[model samples]
Target chain A: MKRNAAAFGAGALFAVGLALSGMTRPAKVVGFLDLAGDWDASLAFVMMGAIAVHFVAYRVVLRRPAPLFDVRFHLPTRKDIDLRLVLGAALFGVGWGLGGYCPGPGLVSAAAGSLGAIVFVVGLTAGMLIEQAVARALPRRE
Target chain B: MHDFTPIPALIGGAIIGLAASLLLLTHGKVAGISGLYGSLLRQGTSDRAFRLWFIAGLAAMGMLVRLTWPAAFASAWSASLPVTLLAGLIVGFGTQLGNGCTSGHGVCGLSRLSVRSLVATLTFMGTGFATVFVVRHLLGGAR
Candidate 1:
């Protein structure tokens, strides 16, 4: 129960940050990506801020033997860079550039009652289901 | 162009990082939204309660912000129906295959100082720039 509560609070705070930082706005996201045109470099600041805080926090928290709630820190273990990784990232980039909505913003905007966001999220769900199916066929990774 | 909000961007981003830190210190989990959502759909994903509660919280916050600060979502992007759907599909499929998105790779993965995350980030950013170039410059549509 405590863990669940923590998760909830974290998600809520994350949404607040995303919205406040203008990440919820697709136009701002694309504008940052638009290098040729009058580029808005605000997204860089977002990243810089996020990374700066996280870099220190991650190290400090990791120094503890374990987390407060869990016995072990559950983290992704795979380290190899393969075709799947590169191809998948490149494909994701195309979609992000075209729509300017990654998973977080897409879900948030959809819940915020944007019609276009709803459409995009529906497509995103379908795509995820499709990827799940494909992943099953390929060698599954942890 | 929207006014450059460096202050809000930096502060909001710090909040995001703080949230991630809290989750990590408390639960020992990386706060990757894509990974959280994607794993929920799997057949036997353990730790189901956390994922559900987290996503529910995200949606709840969104609804709350809608009532309070509508302008945050004011500039919702809308393209042709087909294009919008296709873009969503690609993003979904790609993130799942890649095993992370901005939050996962950009925020958490990068924080760990992982080389894999770095490469993935550059790859996606590169293609993002290229795709935007094609759409805005070549195709004459990016608005």
Candidate 2:
């Protein structure tokens, strides 16, 4: 229960941040990306602020031998610059430019009952499910 | 730069960072939305509870925003239905295939100074800029 509570609290804070940053709106996001046109540089500030804080805070948190609730950190250890990563990111970028909604803000916007956000989430879920199904059906290389 | 709001963006971003920090300090977890959301779709996972609660909290905050700040929720992107649907589908597939999205790779992964995330972030941003340019400038914007 406590762990869940912590998760909930963190999620709430994150959502609030997104909202306050004006990132909950697709227009703002797309505007940020539209550098050639009338670009909105607010999102850059958002990224800078987040990176600055997390950059400092992560080191502070890691100094502790263990987290309060877990035995070890669950960090990603992959260091590959493979084709899949590039292709996936390129696809994601197109989607982001097309819809102006990433996973976090998409869910948040969907919660707010935006029709566009709903459509985006549906497509996103379908894509994820399809990938899972295909991966399951295929043979493993490793 | 008519709507270039730096202060609020910075504040909100700091809050997001704080949230990420809290999750790490307490749960030893990365607050990547796609990773958390993806796990919920899977079955027989003991860690499902936290993810569910986290998502629920995100939704609840949206509700709160809707009730309090409706203008903040307003959007400017007015693409057609088919276009929006396709975009969503592509985004979903891309994030999953890549194993992360803006939050996972852009925020959390980059902060950890992961080389893979750096490449992913750059690739996505480059493509995003190009797509927007093509859609808005070359194609004369969305309908």
Candidate 3:
């Protein structure tokens, strides 16, 4: 219960940051990407601020032997660089550039009930289902 | 330059970082939206409870933001249906395929100084910039 509570609060806080930062707006995202055009450099500041705070917070939290509820931290430990990582990120980049909605803002926008955002989410889930099928065929790495 | 908004961007980013920190401190879970949302479609997962609650909270706040700040979604992107759908499908597939997205790889992963996250971040950011350049400059602006 406590863990779920924390997760809920964190998720809400995450939304607050996204909205306040104007990340929920995709045009800002596209503007940030348009280097040759009138570039909106706000995304850089968002990243810089997020990283600066998380840099300190991450180290401080890991000081504990275990997380508050979990027995251990479930950090990603994979070190191998395979074809999947690069290709996947590239594909995601294309999608992001085209749509201006990554997972976080995509979901939020969808929840706010825009037909386009909803359609994007539908396509996204279908894509996930397809990827799941493909992944199942490959040998498990982790 | 005129579009530069360092104030809200920084303040909002710090909030996001704090939220990520809260999730990590309590649940040891990386605050990646793709992973959290993907977990819904996943099976044999014991941690599904928190993921659902997380998304629920996100949705609730989404509506709240709409109420409190209507202007946030006012200038929403108006991509064609095909483009929006294609983007969605590709994003979902790619994030799952890559094992992370902006929040996972961009925020949490980088904070940990993981070399792999660094590589993934660069790959996505590079392609993102390239795609935008082609669409806006060569093809005459996507939206």
TM of each candidate vs. truth: 0.96, 0.97, 0.96
Clashing pairs in 1: none
* Model 1 lDDT tens row, A1-142: 8888998998898899899998888888888888997688998888888999999999999999999989988878889998778888899999989888889888888889987788889998888889999888887664
DockQ of each: 0.78, 0.83, 0.81
Superposed Cα deviation of residue A132, candidate 1 (Å): 0.8
Interface RMSD (one decimal) of model 1: 1.2
lDDT of 1 by residue, B47-83 (tens): 8998888888888899999999999887744566677
For model 1, state the Cα shift of residue A21 in Å.
0.6
Q: After superposition, how far is residue A101 of candidate 3 from its true place, in Å?
A: 0.5
Native contacts, share recovered per candidate: 0.77, 0.80, 0.80
> For model 3 chain B, where is the 10-residue window of minimal lDDT?
B70-79
Each model's lDDT comes to 0.87, 0.87, 0.87
Cα shift from native, residue B103, model 3 (Å) = 0.3
